[model samples]
Target: MPIDWSPLKEIIDQQNRFVLTSHVRPDADALGSELGMALLLRSLGKTVQIINPGATPAHLQFLDPDGEIKSVHDAPALKQAILECDVHIVLDTSAWGQLGEVGKLMQKSTTQKVVIDHHVSSDDLNAIQFKDTSSPATGCLVYDFTQAIDHTPSARAASCLYAAIATDTGWFRFPSTTSKTMRTIANLIDAGANPAELYTLLYEQAAVPRLHLSGIVLQRVATACHGQLAYTYVTQSDFARSKAHPADTENLVNQCMTIAGIRAAFILVQQPNRKYKVSLRSRVDFDVTPIAEQLGGGGHRQASGAMLPGPKDAALKKLIQLFEEELKKQPPAEKNH
Candidate 1:
C-alpha cells in the first residue's frame, strides 16, 4: 500500500523539536530537501535541527539559511540534539545503511523516525516511510509535504527546493524529469525562487580548480568496446595538483557520457586506505543499477555508484574487465535509430 502522509500533519503539529538529516555525500537534492523541510517546519513554530554526517560541499553552502546545519564530525552537540528531538526526518536517503553507523543511533533514539525520499530501493527504516520513486526529486516530496500543512513556502524554502529539483533533473535534461517537475519548478519560481541566482550559485560560481581537475580527468579518459563505454580515474596526485576536494568531482562521470558515441561512462576516485569510489552513468537504455548492486551499492538504472575495497589501479582494472564481460552479452548495436 502507498504511504499516506495525512497523519504526518498531526505528528508535525504536536512536535516541538524536529531533527532533519540526509544521505552521506549528499547531492543538492538531499541537502536542499532537508533544508527546505527544516525551514518550513520552523515556520510552523517547530524547533528544527538539521544534521548530516558529512560536511557540506562549498558549492552547496548557500542552501543553509543561518548556517544551522551541524556536521556530525565537528559538533558533539548533534548527539544530544538527536536524542532530545521529538521527531527525526531523513531525506533523500533510502536506507538506514545509507546513514552508515549513524543509523544505529537513530534506531536507539526515542524520537519518532520518519523518512521522506524518492529513491526506488530504500530499506524503509523509519516508523513512517514516505517514498515515491516516481517523484523527480525529494524536494518535490517536501513541497507536497509543505502544501499538506497549508504553509506557503518561504523564499529560502523555494530556493532550496528549486536547487534540489534543478540539479537532480540535470537542469531538466534527465529522463526522470516530467511535466510535474516543470509545474513544481514554476510554482517554486512564483513563490520567489530566483532561477538566475540558483544557476549562478550551482554552475556559474564553480571554482577554477574544479575545471582544471575536470580537464585533467578528461585528458586521461579511456574508451573500450568500440567507444561504447568510457572511464576516467582520479588519483591523490590529481587532487594535490588541482587543490580540489572529492566534492568537486561530483559530476565528472557525466562528462564522459557527453561524448556522442559513448553509451556509458565510469569514474573511479582513489580514496585513502587503498579504497576506490566508482560512479557510473548510462545514456541509452542500459541499466547501471545491476553493476552498482554487484558492488554492494544501489541507485537509479541510468546512474548509479559504488565503492570498491581495494587499490585504485587494481579496482579500475577489475571494473574495466567487468564492463567488457557485460558488453559481450549485449546484442550488436543497431545502425539506425
Candidate 2:
C-alpha cells in the first residue's frame, strides 16, 4: 500500500525554517527519522533544527557525530527556533505525552506543525499529519519523502535512514517488516550504508549495565496460559543495583518470546515517578497494540506499551489478568502454532 505524499510534500515546499523532533526517550527510529528528514530538508536549502526532549542514548550517539540532537538543556534555544521556524516536523510518534516539553511548546506556538509518523496515534493533533500505520518505520516514510522531492540523500542521510528502519523493524525480524521495507533498506545500503558497522554499533557496543539489567528482568519471567504469555518486570531496585538507565533495557522484553509457547511478552519497568512503564511484544499470534491502547497507549501489533499507575506487583498482576482476558476473546485460528 502506497502512502499519498502530496500533502506532506506541499507542506514541506511551503516551509523554510523547520524544527524536527520526536517522542521522549528517543529510540533509534525516533532519532533516526528526525536526523534523516533534517538531512533531506537541509539538502533542499531549508533551515532545520532537530530538538528532542531527551538526550540520545549512548548506544545511538554514533548517528550524530557532531552532537546535532538538542536536549532539555537547549530548551531556551528551541524556544527561539520555535518562534522563528515556519513548521515543526514531529517524527516517529504522534502522542503529545510522548513528546514531553516539546509537545507543549508546539501546542503553544503559533507556527504550523506536521506529524510524520507511523504509530497508532494517541491523540488528534489537529495539525497536518502524514501517519501511516503500515509503514515499518518513519524512516521509510522519510525515504519516500526524499524520493517524492526528487532528491537522493547523501551517505549520511542514508545511514540515518538505515538505522531508523533497522531498529523499528527489529533488524527486519518483526512482522511489521514488509517487502517494500526491505527494498527501501536496500536503497539506503546502495546509497552507502554499512550494515556490519551499523549492527556492531547498534547491537554489540552495549554497556555492562544493560546485560546486568537483562539478567535481573529475565530472572523474574513467569509464564501463564499454558506458557503462551510470558511476563517480567524491573523495579527501581533493579536499576539501582545495575546502574542502568531506562534506555539500556531496550529489546529486553522481546527475550520472553524466545521461549517456545510464549506468544506474548511483557516488560514492566518501574519509573522514577512510581509509574510502571510497560513494554509489550507479541510473537506470531497476539496483537498487543490494542492491549496497550486500553491501558492508555498505542503502537504496532507486535510491539506496544503504556504507563500504569499503582504499585509494581499490583499493576503487573492486573495487566496479566487483562492479558488473559484479551487472549480468551481472540479467535482460535490466531493462536501461535
Best-fitting candidate, scored by lDDT: 2
**lDDT of every model, 2 decimals:** 0.84, 0.85
Task: Put down candidate 2 lDDT per residue, 123-142, tens digits, no spaces.
Answer: 86657878888888999999
Q: Relative to the unseen true structure, what is the C-alpha lDDT of residue 55 in candidate 2, on a scale of 0 to 100?
A: 87
Each prediction's number of clashing residue pairs: 0, 0
Supply the global lDDT for candidate 2.
0.85
Candidate 2 ranges with C-alpha deviation above 4 Å: 72-75, 122-124, 212-220, 233-248, 267-279, 287-325, 334-337
Point out the worst 10-residue segment of candidate 2 by lDDT.
328-337
Per-model TM-score, in order, reads: 0.85, 0.82
Q: Could you give me the TM-score of model 1 versus the true structure? A: 0.85
Per-residue alpha-carbon lDDT of candidate 1 for residues 1-337, written as tens digits (9 for 90 to 100)? 3447887887887779988888888889999998899888888888988888678876688787467877776667787788778998999986777775456678888679888988866377756888888887999999988776677899888999999999988899878888978988999999999999899988887788999999899899889878889999998889999998887898799888888788789999988665888998886557777788888987877788999976777887788787777667664467786
TM-score of model 2 (CA atoms): 0.82
